[model samples]
Target: MIGVDTNVLVRYLAQDDEAQSPVASKIIDGFTPDAPGFISQVALVETVWVLTRSYKMTRDAVADTIETLLRARELVVEGAESGYLALASYRATKADFSDALIAHGGRLAGCRETVTFDKGAASAAGMRLLGAD
Candidate 1:
């Protein structure tokens, strides 16, 4: 299986990048049923972060992107269901409550553990630091 990174996904989603979108589309299309493409949990997280922060996608747009990603035939990840639920919950909460809702959704989706760089999120149930640092 071929592994895709956040940049690839961003290029696929953000067609505004004239130089990269076509290439991204070609790469995505090349992955037929015989040859599947995969993406890691870290890639998914980074994709969302980039879409929201750099591309200025709204919460709804992010959710839509994630839903499209989940529907793809070849994508792979560890906690896809949990991540989807977390995104949904993130959309519903007030700014201050978003992390709490994400944590709750993570638990509800049967996540054995969640990893985040945010200290507050790390303290939430079922969450752990992405690294010891």
Candidate 2:
């Protein structure tokens, strides 16, 4: 079972990047009854974030993306509750809670380190901020 990453779903939904769309399409299409695709909870949450923020998709569009993924039956998720709650709180906090949840969830999941882009989150407690790129 191949693990689907957030970028794959984002590219499939966005369809704006010509170079990667065919690859994304093929990957998604492979999730047939015989050959199913798989995705993690983190990918699901990140996909929503990318769809809304990066692609400028509306809430309805984001919902449609999620619906399509759910219908695929190929996607598998872990920590569904954590992902949902993290996304919800992140959205509610206007992105402020994203890193916090990521850090907290990572710790709960027994990760050694939680990497993030938010400086505030890095300073909070257990998160490590990535260098500016």
Candidate 3:
């Protein structure tokens, strides 16, 4: 499988770059289930961050985009099961996608609970609040 990076994904999804979008589309379109484009966890997180923070896409839109990627036959996202778990959490709560991913990754790795100082992460991502009473 060929590795796909955040910029390529962003370009494809955003379609904002005049010169790069078509190139990104061509690369992504060439993938198939037999030889899929591989999206790493870091790339996925960064893509979401850019889509949300940079592009100003709404939460629902970001969720929809992630869902599409998860279901795409031409793509193989790393830690897909964990990604689904995180996606569900992200949809239901106001947690950052990265925070939800961290919580889910911890759970899959047999962590009893993830500890976090961020109150939003602790509350929304199912992490245990550090030093909470």
Candidate 4:
């Protein structure tokens, strides 16, 4: 499998770069299940950040993008189970995708609880409050 960078993925999905989009598409779309492209967790997070912060994609759209990536047979996502759990949490709650991913990753790692100072994460992502009374 070949590793995919965040920029390549963003270029492919966004299709906004006139000079790079076609090339990104050609490489990404050419992948097959037997020779899948691999997306790392860092790249995935960066892609989400760019989609939301830069592209201003709506929550539903971001979710759809992530779901599409997860379901793609020509791609291998790192920590896929955690990604799925995070997606479920993101869809069902007010938690950010990164927070939900952190919580789910902790759970998968056998953490009794993930402690956090962010109330949104604590309440929405099932993380334990670090200093709540």
Clashes of 1: 0
Per-residue accuracy of model 2 over 41-80 as CA lDDT, tens digit each? 6687688777778788776666556656655566555655
- Candidate 4 lDDT over residue span 40-88, tens digit each: 9888888889999999998889999999999999999999999999999
Per-candidate TM-score against the hidden true structure:
0.68, 0.57, 0.96, 0.96
Deviation of model 3 at 22, angstroms:
0.8
**Over the full model, what C-alpha lDDT does candidate 4 score relative to the true structure?**
0.94
> Which lDDT tens digits does candidate 3 get at residues 1-133?
8999999999999999999999999999999999999999999999999999999999999999999999999999999999999999999999999999999999999999999989999999999988857
| lDDT score for residue 57 of model 1 | 84
In candidate 3, what residue range of length 10 has the lowest lDDT sum?
Answer: 124-133
Clash pairs, model 1 backbone? none
> Which residue runs of candidate 1 sit more than 4 Å off their true CA positions?
94-133
Residue-wise C-alpha lDDT for candidate 1, range 1-133, written one tens digit per residue: 8888889888998877889989988988788657878877677778878988898988788778877776677666546665666666556643212354457556766777657777666654335768754
Q: Locate the minimum summed-lDDT window of 10 residues in model 1.
A: 93-102
Q: Which stretches of candidate 4 lie over 4 Å from their true place?
A: none
Better candidate number, 1 or 3, judged by lDDT: 3
Q: After superposition, how far is residue 59 of candidate 2 from its true place, in Å?
A: 1.5
TM-score order of candidates, top first: 3, 4, 1, 2
Q: Which rank order by lDDT, best down to worst?
A: 3, 4, 1, 2
